[model samples]
Target: MKTVQVNIVTPDGPVYEADVEMVSVRAESGELGILAGHVPMVAPLKIGAVRLKHSGSTELVAVSGGFVEVRPEKVTILAQAAETSAKVDVDRAKSAKQRAEEHLNHPNESDVRRAELALKRALNRLNVAGK
Candidate 1:
């Protein structure tokens, strides 16, 4: 069986590091699926959940935004922020979502985009946590 070394890093520290069969993430172009022996490339990632497949199990991780560096033997993710399902607090994410929505209602032109991104990050965490 082939495997690719995967590492997910955030400003705080490494969120994940492992050898896996495959991984998938939301790239600027869309969802990009990477398997062992994939072509080398670099892409920007959107605010969403990244899925990784190991032997027979899958894990979901949420990232606010990031960049993915792909190589035949490894894949590296540099994320602005990241969270695992077990580490996420559903209530907190819900509250964040609500706050973001409220901010959007006020519609500050300068902060509207930031508010939307906050909502996206919260929703991504909720999805990863299966809330």
Candidate 2:
């Protein structure tokens, strides 16, 4: 089976670096999949989960937002922030989700959009964490 070198990085540092058989990411256009020998292209990422499949395992990472660059034998993801399931704090995510939901329900004129984004981020983390 063919594999591709996939690297996921953020401003602080590299997050995930691995050779995988396939990767699926949330792009602006929607969910997209890439495999070894994929056409070279760059796509803006959305706030969601990045799923990668290797020899016999699958890993998930929650990303705030960023861009992905795909090449014939390599793929790179530059994200604003990222969190792996093992590193996520379920309680914190749940709290954030609750706060965001409350804020959204109250409909604060100034913080509504922020709250919505926060909710999305919280949900993304929870989803990756499987909680």
Candidate 3:
């Protein structure tokens, strides 16, 4: 089976770099899967979990928002913030989710967008961490 080199990067540092049998992520339009020999393209990614399959194991990573560049032999993810399942703090994420929920419930347009983004990020982390 052929594989593609996948590198996930964030402002902090590189999250993961490995050869993956397959990669799936949520694009702005919809979910997309990348495989080796895929045509080159770039797409904006949404806040969600990125699934990476290699060998017989699958890994999930949470991305706040970013872009994915796919080439024939490689896939690169540039995320605003990214965290692996092990790196996610469930308690912290839960707290953030609660705060965002509270803020979103209020009728304030200025903070609503930020709160919504926070909620999405927290939920994405929780989902990826299997919490």
Candidate 4:
């Protein structure tokens, strides 16, 4: 089976590095599925799960948003924040979701947008964590 090198990096450091059969991610335009010899391109990523397929199994990585650079044999995700499913703090995500929801209910104009983005990030994390 052919594989592509995938690296997920954040400001702090690299989060994941592996050779996988395929990679799927939610881009700003839409969801994209990439194979070993995918065409080179760059796209803005959304706050969502990055699904990696390898050895007939799928792994998930949650990303807060950033950009993905693709090459024929490599994919690099430079995210603002990212966490593996096992590394997600479910309790913290839930709390953040709740807070965002509360803020949304009575948000000031400026805070409304920020709160909405926060809510989206929280929801993405929880979803990726399978909560």
| Candidate closest to the true structure, highest TM-score | 4
TM-scores for every candidate against the unseen true structure: 0.95, 0.96, 0.97, 0.98
Name the regions of candidate 1 deviating beyond 4 angstroms: none
Better of 1 and 2 by TM-score: 2
Q: lDDT at 40 for candidate 3?
A: 99
Model 4: runs farther than 4 Å from truth? none
Q: Write down the RMSD of candidate 1 (Cα, Å).
A: 1.0
Q: Give per-residue CA lDDT, model 4, range 19-120, as digits (tens).
A: 999999999999999999999999999889999999999999999999999999999999999999999999999999999999999989999989998999
Find the 10 residues in a row with the least total lDDT in model 3.
104-113
**Residue-by-residue lDDT tens digits, candidate 2, 1-131:** 89999999999999999999999999999899999999999999999999999879999999999999999999999999899999899999999999999999999799999999999999999999999
Whole-model lDDT, model 1 = 0.94
How far is 49's C-alpha from truth in model 1 (Å)?
Answer: 0.8
Per-residue lDDT for 79 in model 2?
Answer: 97
- lDDT value, residue 80 of candidate 2: 94
Error of 3 at 106 (Å): 2.1
Q: List the residue pairs that clash in candidate 2.
A: none
The TM-score between candidate 1 and the true structure equals 0.95
Model 3 ranges with Cα > 4 A deviation? none
Q: What tens digits encode model 3's per-residue C-alpha lDDT throughout 12-73?
A: 89999999999999999999999999999999999999999998999999998899999999
